[model samples]
Target: MHASVKMQFDAIANDYDRQRKQLIPCFDEFYGMAVSLVECEPSSKVLDLGSGTGLFAGLVMQKYPDIHLTLMDLSDSMLDGARARFSRTDRVQYIVGDYSEYAFSGQYDAVISSLSIHHLTHPDKQRLFHTVYRLLRSGGIFVNADQVQGHTPAADAYYRKQWLEAIHRSGLTQEAIDSSIERRKLDINATLSDQIGWLEAAGFTDVDCMYKYLDFAVFYGKKA
Candidate 1:
């Protein structure tokens, strides 16, 4: 599963950022909410878990220019794009490995992920929540801008239908759309409620889903 996911993302590494907005109907608000919740000092350290192409981390950098960011991803090709994205600066670091199993050193003021954690299995997702909690300093935050499963079978179907219809009309080429769909097959999204519960179980306080539009949601929590 990991190999297939790596290959698919590697194939689209160069074009991933270009297709993001069109593929995500609520692109602006979804990411905007995530960035706004990354409360920290300007010089704080942050880890962008599953930070494919460093897209989310880039937005955070724009908001806090002096922040030190560590971008970790399973795909080296994806990290290659991130390397170029932050090439002008020496404040960023890259790690090519599975974040779920990586033995990261030190702690961070904030840990954020975007459109990446959904690819993990349910158990792995829960374990990662605990890892993120352990990696943060007290009062640090965790913001996840990613997909979710619906509350019910019918709702899940509706969300999928709406997403499919929107992307089909978004003017992407047939090949691009097809590739996007193939990549989505790797997604193993948790329900919004379950995700919130897992965060709480991982010792995150004030856990909540701050924003949601269809299956896409931004989850926020802080270490106390």
Candidate 2:
């Protein structure tokens, strides 16, 4: 992750969770579908890349309580929220570092990320997919719940317009909406189709976009 992006997230660490539902129009269904697609046993090992505040992992834990989880991110302050969220549990672990550059310790049954990864440059996103593929055990799942760019210029413009409309109707204060818009300037999103292709190129099977609404999408794939 870039230092500027890390600093940006650090500044919002305190209010991230509160702002999430307001910023994402399809909050519940977006995350709920991602968690549902995770095929893991109670004892499965999971790694959450860019696990801001552990929100997504928290959802996964609700479904698989005994799964051991490692939350990795570049911002310490963001991880602090996650630490507090899972403070009482020994099954959760934290690593403060860039997910794109970190050396993962072991293979996992499932690797997940949310509202992250889009910050990476296109080349970095491709490399990260390869890394995630290598980090997963055979038959393991990899799911990313994040935003994507449209395939065409006009479609991209429409995506932004639609997002602006939804945010305005989300009941957020003007100041909150402005802050969210500013934060999105750091996004380096790829098209949904490109990401699916990248996953397949990285040797993942059953690669597909499991869910999508405007620009937000949940991509799912598995190692053969």
Highest lDDT model number = 1
Backbone clash tally (model 1): 0
How high a TM-score does candidate 1 get? 0.99
Question: Residue 62 of model 1: what lDDT?
Answer: 96
lDDT of 1 by residue, 70-174 (tens): 999989989998999999999999899989899989999999999989988899999999999999999999999999999999999999999999999999999
Task: Write candidate 2's Cα lDDT for 28-143 as tens digits.
Answer: 99998999999888999999999989999999999998999999999999999999999989999889999888877789999999999999999999999999999999999999
Evaluate all candidate structures by whole-model CA lDDT and list the values in order.
0.94, 0.93
Q: TM-scores of all models?
A: 0.99, 0.97
Give me the displacement of residue 126 in model 1, in angstroms.
0.6
Positional deviation of residue 223's Cα in model 2 after best superposition, in angstroms: 0.6
Worst 10 residues of 1 by lDDT: 1-10
